[model samples]
Target chain A: MQVEFWFEFASTYSYPAAMRIQSLAAARGVTVAWRSFLLGPIFQQQGWNDSPFNVFPVKGRYMWRDMERICEGLDLSLRRPTRFPRNGLLAARVVCSHADEPWIPDFVRGVYSANFAEDAEISDPAVISRCLETVGQDAAAILAAAQMPASKQKLKAQTAEAMERGIFGAPSFLVGSELFWGNDRLEQALDWAARAAR
Target chain B: MQVEFWFEFASTYSYPAAMRIQSLAAARGVTVAWRSFLLGPIFQQQGWNDSPFNVFPVKGRYMWRDMERICEGLDLSLRRPTRFPRNGLLAARVVCSHADEPWIPDFVRGVYSANFAEDAEISDPAVISRCLETVGQDAAAILAAAQMPASKQKLKAQTAEAMERGIFGAPSFLVGSELFWGNDRLEQALDWAARAAR
Candidate 1:
C-alpha cells in the first residue's frame, strides 16, 4: 500500500517531487513513506567532491534552466537559491526524527518551499524550526531531539541503506525491490505500487 | 523550417530518438535536420576518457536497465552491444556526408539499428557500408567518400559546432539558440520550433 520516497533536501528535482508526490499518491490510492536521506556520502563514494552539476559546467548551466522550465510547466515558483545546495544535514535529522509523524509530510514540504521557493538557507536552525512550527510541532523540542546522537545515527544509517540499495540519485521511489530514480519516474513507480497491490 | 537533431551514434537513448524522430516530426508538421556529431570530443573536454556511463559504474548500470525499459516501451529490440560505444567516428563521417541527403534519415536509422539492435560493429567500414546499402546508397562509394579528408573534416567541424553551442550529450535538439538535451525533450524542442515559426 505504500511506496518509499527517498529524497534529499539539497536536491533540486526532489523539490517538485516532494510537492507533488502526496496528492498524486492519494489519487492513486497509495500511501507513501517520505524518507529523507543525504546524497553527500553517496556522491563522495563516487569520487565527486560536489554536485555533478557543479563539476560539469555545461551540464550545470542546462540544469538551472531545466529546473526553471520544469517548475514553469508544473506551475510552481522556483527562485534560484543564492547559495546552491545549502547543507540539509540538520533538516534531514529533524525529518528522520519524525519519520512516522502524521505532520512530517507537511513539515518536509514546508522546508522544501522555504529552500526552493523563498531563496532561504535551509541549513540554518531558525529555518528548520520555522518549518517544524508551521506543521504544529514543538520547534524547540524537535530541534533539540533532532541533534541527539540517536537521531543523527538514524539519519546516517538511512543514507547508508540508500547507497546499499544502488541508489545514486535523489527523488527516487522504491516499490519493494524495484528502484525508480528521478522525479520523472514518479507516476511509473506509483503505477507499479498500485498494480502490486492487485 | 527545421529544428536541429544532434545525436551521437554511440548513445543508447539516441537509438530510439533516431528511430522515431522522422515519423514523429512529420506528424507534428515539423521537418528535422539530422546532424551527426561525436560526443568523444565533448567528453574529452570534460576530462572523461570514456562514456560517463563507463566512468561511473552505478550510473552505467542504471543506464543499461533504463535503456532496456525505454526500448521495451517503444517496442524496439535492444541488444547490449558487445562493446559499449563502439567507435562511432567512421559512422559519423558517413552521416555527415549525407547531412542533406533525402535518404539520410533512413541512413541514420540504419546505423543506429545496426549498432544497438543488430549487434553490428559500426566502426568497421564493412558494417558502415552495410548500413548505407540498406538505405539504398552505393555502399562502396559512400564508405569511400565518408573516409576522405573533406568528409572527415565536415564531421570534425560539426562536432566543434555542437560544442560551441554547449552540447555535451547526444539526442539533443536545437531550436534557434535554445538547447534541449535528451530524448525526453524532443517534443518540447519541436514545440519551440513550431512556436518560433509563428
Candidate 2:
C-alpha cells in the first residue's frame, strides 16, 4: 500500500515519526511518500489562530514532558525548540519546489530535525539554508528558488490541498482515501496501508 | 508521597489504570486515595451531551485499539464493554457514601473490571449489585442508598467539584492542586505527587 506522511516541520511529535517512519515502513514492505505542508492554514480554517498548545498551558506542559518520554522510549534525539511555530514558509516552499524528487523525504526529515532536535529557529533563512546544505543540496539556489513566485504558489496550493483533505494537525497520514491524524495513529495508518495493498 | 486517583467506573481507560495504580503506587511507597466521580456533568460543561468517544467515531476506534495494545503490553485483560457511557450515577454515589472506607479503592477497581474486563453494562442496577456483592457489601442496601435523592445530589455536587478542579475527562489524578486528565498521565501525576510530598 502507498502511505503518504503529511507533516509540518514545527510539530513536536512529528519529529519521532519522521525519524523512524522510513525504516518502519520499509520493514512492513510498504511504499511511503513524504509530504511537507504548513499547519498554519489548517489551524486558521479550524477557527484557531495558534497551536492549541499555546492556548492551553497545562496541556502544553504535559505535552512537552510526554514528548520527552516518547522520544526517550524511541531512542530519538529531542531538544525543545526555542522558537515554536516558526515560520516554515521557506521550508515548505523548498519542499514543494522539489515535490516530485525522491529526496523530498530526506529534506523533510532534515527540516524536522533542525527545528525539533537542534532547537533552531526554522523561520530563519540561515537555518533552513543550513538544513538544505546538510542534505547535500545547494543552499543558496534552493533558498532563492523557494522564494520564487511559482514555488510560493505551490506551497499555498499544498496547504489548500491539506485543508481539503480535512487535515487539522501535523503528522497526519493518508492511505488511499482515509486520513489518520497524529503520530499516535501512525501504526494504525501503516496497518491500514498494508491491508489495502494486500 | 500521597496520591489521589480520581476515576469513573464507566471510563474505558480507567479499568487498566485502576487495576495497576495500587501496585504501582505501593511500589513507590506512595499512598493512594481513590475518589470516584461522574463524568456526565463535565461533558455537559464542555458543551457535549455524550462521551467524546461516542461523539467522534474515528477517535473512538483508535481508543479501543490503543487500549487493547496498552493492556496487552501490561499483561492485563481488556474486554470492550457493550454499553458505553453507562449511567455511572449509582456507582458514583456508592463510592461517595463510602468515601471514608479504606476498601473503597478495591471496590472501585472491581466496578471498573466488571465494566471493562467483563464487558458488563454497569448502568444496570443488577450489574452494580453483583459487583458490590463480590466485595462483601450489602448490595440491596447500597443500591437503595445509591438511588436516594441525597445520593443523586451528592453525585451532582461531586461532578461540579471535578469541573471546578479543571477536570475534563475520566481517569484523572490530582497532585496537590494540579489536575492531570486521562490514564496516560498516571505516571507523570505520580511523579509530581512524589515531588510535592517531599
Model 2 C-alpha lDDT per residue in residues A1-198, reported as the tens digit of each score = 889888887788788888888888888888887778888876665445778577555457767876886888788888888866677888878887787677777888888888878888888899888888877889999899887898888878888888777666789898876877777778878888888887
Q: Residue B6 lDDT in model 1?
A: 99
Q: Candidate 1: which pairs clash?
A: none
- Per-residue error for A1 in candidate 2, Å, reads 13
The lowest-lDDT stretch of 10 consecutive residues in candidate 2 chain A is A52-61
Which parts of model 2 are misplaced by more than 4 Å?
Answer: A1-6, A15-50, A54-90, A93-127, A134-136, A143-198, B191-198
Q: Candidate 2: what lDDT?
A: 0.79
Per-residue C-alpha lDDT of model 2 across residues B62-123, encoded as one tens digit per residue: 57766886788789888887778777777888998787787677788878887778888777
**Tens digit of lDDT per residue, candidate 1, span A51-161?**
888989899999888899889999998999988878999989988878888998999999899999999989999999898888888999988998899999999999999
Candidates' C-alpha lDDT: 0.89, 0.79
Question: For chain B alone, what TM-score does every candidate structure achieve against the true structure?
Answer: 0.97, 0.93
- Which prediction has the highest lDDT against the true structure? 1
Q: What lDDT score is found at residue A198 in candidate 1?
A: 92
